[model samples]
Target: MKLLNDDLRNQLKEVFQDMKDDVTIAVFTKSGTCNTCTETISFMEEIETLSDKIHLKKLDIENDAELAKAYDVQMVPSIVLLNKDEAYVGIKFNGIPAGHEINSFIPGILEVSGSGEQLPEGFLKQLETVKKPVNIKVFVTLSCPHCPGAVQKAHKLALENEFINAEMIEAQTFDEISNKFNVSSVPKIVINDQYEFVGNQPLEVFVEEIQKTQA
Candidate 1:
């Protein structure tokens, strides 16, 4: 049972061709308790086969507790992307990046591989003002067409600022956490677990919400 079909594989190969540097996909999973853990690893295996520059590291949340703690992984079936230097740059996916999330996942790889587009000078300057630690949780449903855009925007902000970290959480898979946050809508962006907005908003909206944390 292959997760990625031939058509998707071919497309990913073409997309991965633009990778300028190596990127490691470190996936954390637990054995029996986690439902999507196995499926997520299988999906990642397919992704690794597409590009020589993309490396995969499979780990268990329990057995690799120390490393998982270092990366601040709090859940199973989580993914952390590392740069060519294997440094954790605060990009993460807490569930399988299937469906529309493939949009965010591929771009995340490219960003870590040093092939991402640069943010505008104005945006860069705005990002520089973020001095406080910020955690961005983007709650998404796989079927939502607009969810990936919000996830990508959150990830792009994380990549530009070391003080910020972002994770895309599949709302259905993490329903309990979603319930805690009262996520009744798709593409719900929660910043620092305090402020929240719903939509595929512009980067300016994201920055404004993040800046609110510094206040």
Candidate 2:
């Protein structure tokens, strides 16, 4: 069975029309051990059929170890989006972006395609203060309605600052990591594996939490 229905596919085509540049989606998956790897690839295949600007690259965690390492990918069914120049700008998804997670996934592609909304200048200035390396792991379940907003905010910060990297991790799919972070909520935001918060917070809240890491 196909993941995207006719209505969804048509809606996606309309959305892809707004893509300003090329986006290369590099997917990393490992065989045998990963339960969702096959389904993830099939979903991506359907996505690739939606637009000419969207390119899909299939890779394995084992076969593409060096490349995966360069992107800091440590899990299966991971997706790394590269910009028009094929540069990795630190946007990633660590599980199948299905269900409500599609909201973030689609916007991520548009952002990488150079058609993203611009952040306020004040907020852009605030982002400059982040000098130290920061990793944001947004733990979410596919069915969570509000989880995508949190994921989008995290990825937007990653796009604005080089020192920051963000990823949307499906909670149930990667329960071991979720347990490590003590995630019992729908949208759990963990920063640097040290600081954490829950819910679809405002941009100011995200900035404030990140500032704590610098201090």
For candidate 1, what is the lDDT?
A: 0.94
Q: List the residue pairs that clash in candidate 2.
A: none
lDDT of 1 by residue, 187-214 (tens): 9999999999999999999999999999
Q: Model 1, poorest ten-residue lDDT window? A: 1-10
In order, what lDDT does every prediction score? 0.94, 0.95
Q: What is the lDDT of residue 155 in candidate 2?
A: 97
Clashes per candidate, residues 3 or more apart or on different chains:
0, 0
Report the number of the highest-lDDT candidate: 2
Candidate 2 positional error at 109, Å: 0.4
Off by over 4 Å in 1: none
